[model samples]
Target: MTAKWREREKTGIRMGRRRRMDMILFNMVREELRGRVRRLKPDWNQLFDRANANKSDRWRCW
Candidate 1:
């Protein structure tokens, strides 16, 4: 094979490896975010519920 053909082949291999790494990293980040959201969702709901409860109490007082 010519030198240019060899170079192109090496470049293609490197790009394929990079794409696979990117996908792995992306999935890791996505799972981490999903876990965080799962943990935080209940806290978020509790906060919202408290805020609404307080608002209703104030309306009753007034």
Candidate 2:
């Protein structure tokens, strides 16, 4: 392979690995938060509460 093609392949591999790591970390954190909300007191879990259907319908609350 040409030097330029080899360099591009190396970069692509590195980027793929980084993307996978980011997705893994994101899923781990999301699961952790879900677990914490389930175990915590109701007051502490207000953000995750679904009491207000109207708030959820919007694209962005903030």
Per lDDT, the best of the predicted structures is: 1
lDDT of model 1 at position 54: 44
For model 2, where is the 10-residue window of minimal lDDT? Answer: 53-62
List runs of model 2 lying over 4 Å from the truth.
Answer: 1-15, 38-62
lDDT of 2 by residue, 1-62 (tens): 57775666567557685465456546755666777776654343453343333443221211
lDDT of each: 0.52, 0.50
Pairs in steric clash, model 2: none
What is residue 51's positional error in candidate 2, in angstroms?
A: 34
- What TM-score, to 2 decimals, does candidate 1 have? 0.38
Task: State the lDDT at 20 in candidate 1.
Answer: 59
Q: Estimate each model's TM-score.
A: 0.38, 0.38
For candidate 1, give the lDDT: 0.52
Clash counts for the predictions, in order: 0, 0
RMSD of each: 22.1, 13.6
